[model samples]
Target: MNTDFLKVLFEISEALVTEELAALKFLSLDHVPRRKLEAIQEPKAFFEVLQEKDLIGVGNLFFLKELLYRICRIDLLTSLGSSREQMERELRILGRALVSAYRQLLYRIAEDLTPEDVANVKFLLQKLLPKNKLQEDASMLQIFLEMEIKEIIKEDNLEFLKDLFQRVRPDIKKKIEAYEGKRKENYSREEVRYPVSVQPEEKGAEGGAAKEHGKIYKMKNNPHGYCLILNNYIFKNPSYNREGTLQDGEAVKQVFTWLQFETVEYMDLERKDICDTVKEYSRKDHRNMDCFVCFIFSHGEKGKIKGVDDECVNIEDLVSCFTGTNCPSLAGKPKVFIIQACQGSEPHPSVKVEPDCSGHLEVDASPLTSIPDKADILIGLATVEDCVCFRSHETGSVYIQSLCEKMRLLCPLGVDLTSILTEVNNEVAGKELEGYKQMPKITSTLLKRLVFKVPQ
Candidate 1:
């Protein structure tokens, strides 16, 4: 290597902390083997290994830039004559980002956690790791490495880590959820780009069937479609105010906007106004659009949800407004209805386990049979029939927040709408809240995979 290049590497090495060195090594596992990385303890030696592997050189500093970016040491990129914006633009190309998003997510969680949080995490893993490895001062990155070595937490298998985080740090657990969402999306895209061969029976069951019934739905419009959010927060009854519902509205708006949808949210809509708004959108000229989405957040009783005036609106009525017969302009296009309300007044029982948050949960009632008997329609309910859903007075309803998170993470990777709802179901069902659980339900009659095309 050139003298100046060597000096620059040395300077960058000196700038990295011990935890960052470990992160750099972990991120480079795809390039360098784990056994070789385990022997290198210091940053300088790690850089030497990178040099031996031909990852960094006089003219090539791409991998080095990726490593620094993964560890969030963008300031050190200045030493290598690169800026954060330049690296971002270059990494936008496919296959240019060497580090896996999974590894980066773990490293980010490690960086965000405080020292006390690390200690608590280590304490939780006392039975899993060697006593010597779980010393008083062991870092979170080191604990992660030990977990990886023991095959407890792999890139694909993160349930153990997620469970642990739910106990000590729920916020960090959310980071994992977001990562899984994005990872699933990328996997779906990869399957589309580079399909693998399968056995005849398997192909008939999965691939052949997909080809027989069209591969993916058409979504070529500039603004792909409309995302209508019917958020009912305040009500005529003083006790019916839906606290923290605005958070859900804002979350959906942000995600759909990023997905190139014309997101419009109407807060505190009365029963008549809600029906009128749905009819207005259904009558529009949707020839230039690809799909339609609606989100209803409110309180109610079985088979219905309440409007701002404490009047009940049948969930089926809102969904029927966009049916093929009612709205011919949007015929054969996917129409999604997401309801963040309880299906009944009964609390779903679960095995005794620690809860995720301390905030109180209130319930809203509705039915699961909200979708009409029609094609290209889907209804996502917060909970199963006769079961209650949960909402945090501080955050939003569990179902809406999880759904938005999954959409924001997965849509760009081309995951279909139904598959994304499945993920949302898993995430919401996993939560234990105040001695009760919520299981989301999905009812769909779509004929083809409705994979959204994310805007660039």
Candidate 2:
């Protein structure tokens, strides 16, 4: 999105051309034929309208490839303007983008770089020259053009780049593959987390942490608590899509069985009155509790976790009930919420966007990674905001399978709090289909490292 390089390149080059008394030949002069401009503009037109549709005609494909190449060339010329400083800036930026585009073109395009091409470009980057005298660098561009056609994808100096591509390429290929396969993308972004600012809490400060009635109360625990709230078929959605809900509810129901401080399982309540069921759990004291956890398994959208009547419940409203002031039992403890729903409300491919297409960085909810603080609350979400998170007919969600697996291994090894989550994410995302792969993102804000077993 930043085009300041182009402006600098133009200014520096204009000054140098005048100083050198050189005429604008080749591209700079009006002497180049109009047919060339037509060639450059054609690809821009096609790519602009290019959607997820599979396969473009040869005519269109040729136009797009030419357009992209021409744009890259112009960007190079613009970056090298007459000023040495400006040339350096352009060289750095273009060098990075070219290497990247070269990689992308490797899988997407039919070509690779040649030895002469690589050597010449590498020289231009490492060597220093002024923008007006950019001819030194420009000479190498021809070699790049020749090398572009010959088949060669060098492994030299590309391990880091290759590793990065390995981590992300699967996801990108998934999008391309899915679009080619015409797979549906309806269940991806169901869980949306709106922002909430919580003031820092110091224990025993405000009225010794008072408790209120007729509301969901947070119970105290040293580190945290895992809870399970299961809804019967009365509450589950019965859609037939692969991503649709299952009647068993094992995902949300399994949290309570663990041997930990205070476990609660509330079932069969009015769907609209699910919060009332939570109120019932709050009043029923679990003596000597450590922390708090609430699991809501139902179907809804926006930031609201849903219940039986299909009534969507705002996540904030449900989780807010267990705050220190409201639930003294959890005054100095963390409150964990495990949500089995989508975060995104629209269609999204699990594919990672190329760096050039990196969308505006925005703050949003991820899984354990979205923790707001190094201490306090952790929200383990089901699927990323968009895309279908898989749940086997017998095994629940794929992430949960890998999650429980990691915890089985890491918890006993005394893994740090964050590291365990990290491992779980890795295990889960590692599973791949023909082209589909799912990755879970984490967000947390907990103060303590929890080893998930009886502390010896």
Kindly give the number of clashing pairs for every candidate. 1, 45
Predicted candidate 1 versus true structure: per-residue lDDT over 1-456, tens digit per residue: 357668888898888887778778878886689899999989989988887765565444667887887667879976665677767765664434667777777778888899899889888998999999999877777788899899999989899989999999998888899999988998887677434323233445457745554556677787989999999998998788888687677667767776788999998989899889999999998999999998989888778878889888888887888889999988999998888998888998887754454467777766655568899998889999898988877557888877876665466555677888887897677678888888999999888787777655
**Which candidate should be chosen as best, given TM-score against the real structure?**
1
- Residue 382, model 1: lDDT of 92
lDDT of residue 154 for candidate 1: 95
Error of 2 at 434 (Å): 7.3
- TM-scores, all candidates, are 0.59, 0.42
What would the TM-score be for candidate 1 when compared with the true structure? Answer: 0.59
Q: At residue 147, give the lDDT of candidate 1.
A: 93
Q: List model 2 lDDT by residue over 157-227, tens digit each.
A: 33332343344344443444444343223112111111111111323223232221111123224434546
The Cα error of candidate 1 at residue 375, in Å, is 0.8
